[model samples]
Target chain A: MKTIKKVALTALAAAGFGAVPGLFGLPGSLLAPGFAATPGSAMAQECGTITLGAALSLTGKYSTNGLHTKNGYEFAIRKIKEAGGVKVGGKCYNFKVIYYDDESTPARGAQLAERLINQDKVQYMLGPYSSGLTKAIAPVTEKYKIPMVEAEGASRSLFNKGYKYLFAVLSTSEQYLASAVTLAAEVAEKRQGKKPSDVRIALVVENDPFSLDIRAGVKEDAAKYGMKIVIDDRMPRDLSDVSATLTKVKALKPDVLIASGHSKGAATLTRQVGEMKIDVPMIAITHCESADIIGKFGKTAEGFLCSTQWAETLSYKDPLFGSAADFNREFKAAYDMYKNRSVPYQAAQAAAAIYVFKDAFERAGSLDKEKVRDALAATDLMTFYGPIKFSPAGNNIAKPMVLRQVQNGQYNVVAPSKFASHKLIWPRKVQ
Target chain B: MFGLCDFFAQTCGNLSILFAAPVFNVQLLIDGVLVGAVFALSAYGLALVWGVMNVKNLAQGDFVMVGGYLTWWLTQTFGVSPWVLLAGLVASFALLWGLGWLLYRLVIAKVIDRDLFTSLLATFGIAIVIAQVLNLIFGSDTQSVDPGYESLTLLGGAVTVAPQKLFAFLLAALLAAVVITFMKRSRMGQAIRATAQDPRAARVLGIDTDRVYAFTYSLNAAICGAAGALIVMIWVIQPFYGITYSIRAFVIVTAAGFGNLPGVIASGLGLGIFEQFGGFVLGAEFQQAIVVGVLVFVLLIRQIQQAMNRQVVQ
Candidate 1:
C-alpha cells in the first residue's frame, strides 16, 4: 500500500507539471514551432529570413509591458510581411524574431543576449522590455558590435554611455515628466499669482533606473525655477500601497505632485488619491495608458497628466502603417485584447523600432553589420509613431514627448502649446 | 556611502516635519493599524499551522493572493454590489478551505512527518507553483476591488480614513474572534490542540491526529483567504506579491512565538505601525528593508535573552 501510494503521488506530480504550461494557454506544440527552423512555405519568404533576436520579460514583474512589447514586435513583423517583405539587395527577405524570456531580471537578460549572439548566431538584435533589462543586454550587444534597435529603454543614462551600435525609438526618461514641471510653474504664476519659486513639488517615484531618471529630470527643472520640494519619496519596487506618502502630501499641501513607476504606480496613485481625497491641484504620472487607469478607476483618473511618447491623434504618417490613427485601428484589429482599450505608446514605439530596422536594412542595401550600423546611425524617417532621427548618442532626437491629460475618459494633449489640443484643468476636483 | 548619508539626512528632515506638525502622526498611525490588522490575520493562520502540524507553510502569502484574486475575479465577472462582494469573501474562504484540503492530501500530508527542512522545501515549491498559476490566469496585472465607499475626514483633512479599510479591519477582528472562540470551545479544536501538544500521545489516546492536522491546516488557509479578500478590497493584489506577505507572516509568527495567539495579534499590529512610521521617516523605499531589519532585530533580542538565561542557569 505504501509503495502504491508513493507511485501514485509521483504520477500525480508528473501530471501536474505537464499541465502547468498548458495553463498558460500556450500549447507545447505551438512553442516547438518557434524553436524549430523556419519552413519555406510562404511565397513572401522565397528568398530567406532575417532572424533578429530579442530577450523579453515574458514573466515576472514587468511581464505586463513585456507582453505588450512582444505583441508590438509580432504585429510589426506581420505588417511588414504583408507589405511584400523587405527587399534587400534586390532579394526579398521576411523578418523573424528569435525570442527568449528574460524573466524580468538583468542577469538573465545579459546571459540570453550572449546565447542569442553566440548560440543562435542572431546578428541583428531587438531591445528588451524595461530600462534595467536593456541596460543589461546593451553591453553584451555592444561588445559583439551587433546593431540593435530598441523601443523601451528611455533612461538618458543609457544614451550617455556612447554605445555606437545601439539605437532607440522612444524619448529619453528625463523628458517624460519635465513638461509637467514647466506646466506646474506656469499654473503657479498664472492662476495662483505666485512666483515659480513659490511652487511646492512633491515627487514619489519608484526607485528604478527609469523612474529615477524621471525624478532627476523633474528635480533639475524644479530647481531651475527655485521650487520647493516638500515631500520626496521613493516607492518600493512591489508597490501596492502609498497611503503613507499620500498622508504626507496632505500635510505638505504641495502644489504639484509628480510620480513615475510604470503602470502599477499609476493605478495605485489614482485609486488611493481618490479614495483618500488628496486635494492636490496637479498630479502627473507615467504609464496612464498602459495601466488603463481611466478604464479601471473611472472618475478618479480624470485630470491626471500622463506622459507619452506617441499618441494616435498625432499627424505622423508613413508608407507602410499609414497615419497614426490608421495604425491604431489596424493594431486593435490584430490584437483582440486591445480592442476596447487604447493602444499604449509602448506598443507603438516598439513597432516603430521594427520600422527603423526595415528602413535601415533597405537603406544599407547589404546585410553586413558595419553597413547596417551606419544606416541605423543615419536613420531619418517618419512613421506612425513619430520621426526617427538618431542623435550622435543613438537616441531619438526628432520626436518630442507630449503631455496628455485624462479629460472625460479621453487622453487629450494638454501641454507644450504646440501640441495642446485641450486646455489644462486646474485644481482637479475629486468626486 | 553618499546614499546612506542622504538617507540619514532625509530621515532627519522627515523627523523634523513630524515634530513640526504632529497631526501627520495620526494619519501614519491610523494607516499602520489598519494595514496591520490584515497582517495579523495571516500571521495567526501561520501560527496555527506551525504550532499544530509542525509544518512551516511558506505559501501563506500565495494563499492570500489566491483568495484576493478569487474575490476580484468574481466581482469583475459577476457583479460589484456590496452584497455580492460580501458573498465573494465568504466564497473565497470556502473555496480556499477546499484547496487547502486538496493540497494537504497531495503534498503537505506526506511532508508533515518529515524533517523541518522537508516541509519548508515542499511549501516553497508549492508557493512557486501557486504564484505561477495565478500569473497565468490573471495575466500578471495588479488588480483591486473598489468598495465605492467614502472616506472619513478628520483633523481638518490632515487625516482621512477610507471606510472600506475600516470595514476590512472590523471584518478581520471579527474573524479572529470567531476563530479563537472556535479553538477554545469546539471539540475538533481541542483535538487539534492535543495533537499540537504531542502527536504521539494524542495518537495513543485515539485522537485521530491525521484528521486534526488536516483540519488545522485547512482552517489556517481559510483564515488567510478571508484576509486576502479583505486586502483586495482595501489595497491591491498581484501574483508575485505573495512573497511579501509570506515574509511578513514569518516575521510575525517568529516574534510572537508558537501557539501564542495574543502575541501574534499584538506583534502584527506593532509591525504594521512600525512599517508606516519607518516608511514615513526613511522614505517609502525602505519599507521592505524596515520589515527585514525588524526581523533581524527581533531575532537578535531573542538570542541575547536566551544567552542570558543560559548564564543564569550556569
Candidate 2:
C-alpha cells in the first residue's frame, strides 16, 4: 500500500511537469502587447520577404512526388530571387516558402493548412501533391479567404464546389484523357479511313477522384467522337490484383486501352498486360510520365502514350527562364546539384505554379489577398511550363494537353502537331 | 436505406440473368484457383506456428513480403536467373528461416507463453518494424519478376492462362504435399504435435518443447518465404502489401480450424474464387470488401455451428 501511494505521487509529479510549458507559455505572452498588428496595416510597411506556406506529403506513400513538388517550388523561388524579387507596392520583396509535412493524409494536410494560416499568419498558399490532398486543404484556404495557387490536383470536382479562392495551374483531370481520345480518333481516320465513332475503347480507372475525373473526361470525349466504350472498370482498391481486369481485356480485345491510376496501378497494368499478352492497337495510361512507371516498366513501356502538362521540348518561353530548353537545362543542372538526378515533370509544373504567383503579385502590385486573387483570376500569360489562364471554375483550361509517346525508352511529345517532338507511332510495336 | 434496397434488387436481377448467361467463366475460375493456391501456402505457415506454439503471429504476411524482397534483390542486383528463379527462391527461404530464428530469439520468445491478445499485439509491433525496415532497404517501390512466359489460351480462347501462375500453383501444391508428408512421418513433427497437445506430458516424455516451439516458428517463416517467392514471380509486390497477405493468411487459417490441412487448402481456394466473382459481378472496388465480408460471414457461420454442438468459446 505504501509503494502504490508513492508510485501514484510520482506519476502525478510527471504529469504536472509535462503540463508546465502550456501553463506558463500562455500568460507570459500577455506582458508583450506591442506584437499585435493592426488590420490592413500589416502589409503597409516596406516588405523584405513574403512567406508562401504549404502542407506537403514529405513522408508516406506520396513522399516521392511530394519531394519532387518541394524541389519545384524551391527551384522556382531560387530562380526568382536570382532574376530579381517581386515588385509589390513599389518595393522588392523576396520569396520564402514555409512548408510542413502533411504525411500524405488529407485530415493532417487540412490541419497543417489551418496552422499555416492561423498561427504562421501566411496570406498565400501552395497546394500539397495529389488531388485528394489539395481537396483537403482547399476548404481551409477558402475559410481564411487566402488564395491557393496549386500545380497538382486535377479532379474536376475540386472546382465544382463553388470555392472562390482555389486556383489550379494544371489542367483538370478530365482533360487528361480527352486529348488521348482525340489523338486516337485522328489516328483511326488517317490510317484506316475510319470515323472516330468506330473506335472501340477499353477504359480501366482507379476509384480515386483524379482517376474518376479522367474516366468522366474520356467518356465525354468518346461520346463526342462517337467512339464506343467496350469496357469501363475501376481497378480494385489497395490495387492488390488487376488480373481480373486484364483477363476481361483479353476477351474483349478493344481497339484502344486507356488505363489510369496511381504509380503502382501503372506498373501493375504494364506487367499483367505483358503477362496476358493483351495487345491492343494503342495503350494510353495517365501515370506513364511518373518515374515509377518508367523505372519499373523500362523497355516494356515502349509505344505507350502518356498525357502530360509540360514537355521540355515545347516552344513555350518565359521572361525568367528564357526558353523551355533553357529552363530544362538549368532545372536539370540545379536538381542534379541538389539531389543528383533529373527533375520530374511534376516538379517542373510545381515551379510553374510559383511563376503564376509571381505574375499575379507583380500585376496586383500589392500584398492584399483580394487584389492578388483578382489579378490571378485575370491572368493570361505564358511561362516556360505552359500558358497560365484560369477558367471561371479556377481550372487552367486555356493551355492544351500534350500527348507523349515512349519511343526507344524515351518520352517524346507526339500530338498537338505544334508541340510534336516526334511523329505518333500508331499501333504500338510489341516484340 | 432505399438506395441499398434498390441496389440489392438490381443485383438479384443481374444475378438471375447472369446465371442464365454463364457469367462465371472457366478462365475466371481457373485464375481464382491459381491465386488461392498462393494464399493456401502462406496460410499453412500461420496455422503450423499457431497450432504448435500458440503464437498468433500478426507478422505472418510480412514474412512473405520479406521473402519476396530477398528474391528481388538477388534477381535485380546480381542478375541471376537460373532454373526459372529456383536458386533465388531457395536462397530466400534459407535467409527467411534465419530471420525467423532471430525474430523468435529477440521478440517471440518473450511472448511465447502469453495470452493470445498479448502475442497478437506484440506480433503486430513486429509487423510494423519489418514493413518499415523493408521500405528503408528497398525504397518504397513495386517490383516483380519477368519469366517471359507467353500466356496460352484454352477452351476456345475463352480462358487465357499464364505460365508463371501455373508454375506458382504447382510449387505451392508441392510444398504443401512435402509439409504434410513431413508432419505425418517425421520424429520432429510428432514431437511438435505432442507438445501442442500436452506440453507438460510431452516434457515428461523427454521431448524438448522449447526446441519444438523455435523450430515450428522458423519453419513457418520459411514456408511464408517460399510462398512469397512464387508471388513475386507472378504478381507485383510492395513493402506496404505485407498486411493484406497477413490478413488473408489469418482469415484462411482461422476459418479452416487448427490442424485441418485439407480444410485450409479448400478455404483458400474458395476465397480466391469468391473474390474473382465478387470483383466481376459487383466491380473491382469490392474485391477486398468481398474478401473481408466473406471472413465475417464464415466466422458467424462457425459460431452458429459451435453453438449447436454445445460448445462455448473461452
Candidate 3:
C-alpha cells in the first residue's frame, strides 16, 4: 500500500509537468505564431504580399515539364516584383509563389493543394503540370474558394464542369490538333494544288486522355474539311515501339501524318521516320516543343511541324516582357546561366498564368476572394502569350493554338497566319 | 480494306501490288524476333541473379539505364564514333560489373540471408533510390545513340529489319552462348550450383558462398550493362525506363522458372513475339496489358498445378 501511494504521486507529478506546456503554451506559441492564425484573415494582412500556392510535379514522370513550369513561376514573380507588383485597394502588394512537389500523382497533388491552402495559408493558387493533376487539385481549391490560375492542364473535360474558382491559361486539348488538320488542308491546297478533300491524314495518338482529346479534335476538323483519315492508330501504353503502326503508315503513304503522344513518343517517331523512311508530305507531331525531341534526334528533327501552345517567335507583346522575342532572349540568358536550359511553351504558359493573376489582382482593386474572382472572369487583356480571355467555363478561349516547324534546327512558328513567323515547310525535304 | 491490302504490298516492297495475299504475317513476325533478341539478353541476366541469389533485382532496368547513359555520356563527351559500340559495350560491362560488386556488398549482402519478402522489399527500395539518383544526374529526357545502320530487306522484302537490331541480336546470342559454356564447364559454376542447391552443405564442403553470390550478381550486372549498351544503340532510353525493364525481366523469369536456361531464352523470345503481334492485332494500347495479362495467366496456371500436385501427395 505504501509503494502504490508513492507510484500514484509520481504519475500525478509527470501528468502535471506534461500539462504545463499545454496550459501555458510555453515555446510552441512563441516559435510558430502563424500556425494559430487563419490564412486570409490574418496572414495576408500581416505579410503585405499575395501568396499563390502551387502543387507541382517536381520529381516524377512529369518532372521535366514540372521544373519548366516552376521556372516560369519563378521568372514571372521576379518580373512582377520588378514592376512594383500588383495594386490592391491603394496598397502595393508583392507576389510570392510557394510550391510543394506533388510527385506527379493526382491524389498527392490534391493532398498538397489542401495543405498549401490550410497550412501554408496561401490566398491564391496556381495549377499543376498535366490535366490529370489539375483535375485532382481543382476540387480542393474550389472547396476552399481560392482562385486558381493555371498555365498547363489543357484537357477540355476539365472545363465541362462548372467550377468558378479554377481557370486555365493554356488552350484546351481539343484545340491542340484542331489546327493540325487545318494546316494540312492549307498545305495541300497551296503546295500540291489539291482541294481540302484531297488531304489524307494518318493519326497515331498516345492512349491517354490528353492525346485522345487531340485525336477527337483532328477527327472533328477533318470532317469539317471533308479530309479523309487513312489510318488511325493509338501508340502502346509504354510508348516503347511504333514499328507496327509505322509499317502500316509506310504502306498507306497518306498526304499528312498527325501524331500526338508524349515526349518519348515524339522521339520514337522521329527516329523511326528516318529508320523506316515513312515519307508523308506533312508530319505534324505534338510534343516537338519538348527539349527532348530535338535533343534526342538532333538534325533528324528538322522538317516536322509540331502543335504548340506558345512559340517565342510569336509577335505577342506585353508590358512586363516587352515582346515574345524579348522574353525568350531574357529567359534563355537567365535560365541557361542558372540551369543550362532553353524555355519551352509550357514555361511560357506558366509565366503567362502568373501575368493573368497579376492583371486580375490589380483590376479587382481589393484582396477580397469574390472580387478577385470577378476580375479574373472579366479578364480581356493581351500579353506575350496572345490575348488572355477566359470563357464562362473558365477555359482560355482567346489563345489560338500555334504550329511550329523545326527548320535549320530551330523552332519557327508556321501556322495560324497571324502568328506565322515563317512559311509552312511541307514533306520535310529529307536528305 | 484497301489499307490492309496496301500493308501487304508495302511489306513485300516492289512486289506486284496484286500479289498481296500471304498466309504468314512476315512483317510482325520479323519485328517480334528482333525485339525478342533484346529481351533475351536482359532475361538471361535476371534469371542468373534470381536463380543463384534468390533476390529479384528490381533495379535491373536501372542497371541497363546506367549502362545506356554511360555510353551516351562517353559519345557526347568524346564525340565517339557509332562504330565504337563494341568498345562501349566492353567498357559498360566492366563498369557495371563494379557497380554490381558495390551493390552486393552494400545492400544485397544484407538481404541474401533473409526471407524472400525481405529481399523483395529491400531491392524495391534500391530500385527507387537508383531511379531517383539517375533522374537527378540525368534530367528526365529520352536519349538515344545513332548507330548509322540502315534497314535491310529480308525474305524477299517481306520482312524489314534494322541492321543495328540484327547486330544486337547476334551479339546477345553469342554472349548467351559464352555464359552457358562458362556455367557448364567452369569450376566456379559448379561451386555456384552447389551453393544454390544446399548452402549449408556447400559451406561445410569448403565453398565460400558469399564470394559466389557476389560473383553471380556482378555477372548479372555485366550482362545487363552489355544489353543496355546494345539497347541505346538500337532503341531510345529514359531514366524511368528501368521499371519497364524490371517488369519484362520478371515476366520472362516467372514464365521460364528458376535455373532453366533454355526455357528462359525461349520464353523471352516468345514474349517479345507475342507482344509485337498482340500490339498489332489488338491495338498498341493493349501492348503493356498483354505482358501483365500473360504473367497473371501463367501464375494462375502454376497455382492450379501446384494445388493438383498437393492433392495427389495427400
Who wins the lDDT comparison?
1
Tens digits of lDDT, candidate 1, B18-75:
9999999998999899999989998888999998887889999999999999999899
The reply for model 3, stretches above 4 Å from the true place, is: A1-47, A193-195, A337-342, B1-24, B153-159, B292-314
Predicted candidate 2 versus true structure: per-residue lDDT over A308-410, tens digit per residue: 8888889999899878888778888876633433456788889998999988999999888899999999999898888889988899877888888888777
Candidate 3 interface RMSD to the true structure: 3.7
Chain A TM-scores, per candidate, are: 0.87, 0.88, 0.88
lDDT of 2 by residue, B1-314 (tens): 66875766534433443465453367678889998999999899888888878888899888999989888877887664646378777987898899888888888888988888889999999898888788777766577777666678776655678888998899899989998888889999899889888989999999998888888888999999998898888877877788878888888998888767888899999988887777666667778888888888988998888887885544
Docking class of 2: acceptable
Best by TM-score: 1
Among all windows of 10 consecutive residues in model 1 chain A, the one with the lowest summed lDDT is A30-39
Output the TM-score of candidate 1.
0.90
Clashing residue pairs found in predicted model 1: none
Candidate closest to the true structure, highest DockQ: 1
Q: Order of all candidates by TM-score, from best down to worst? A: 1, 3, 2
Give the better candidate number (1 or 2) by TM-score.
1
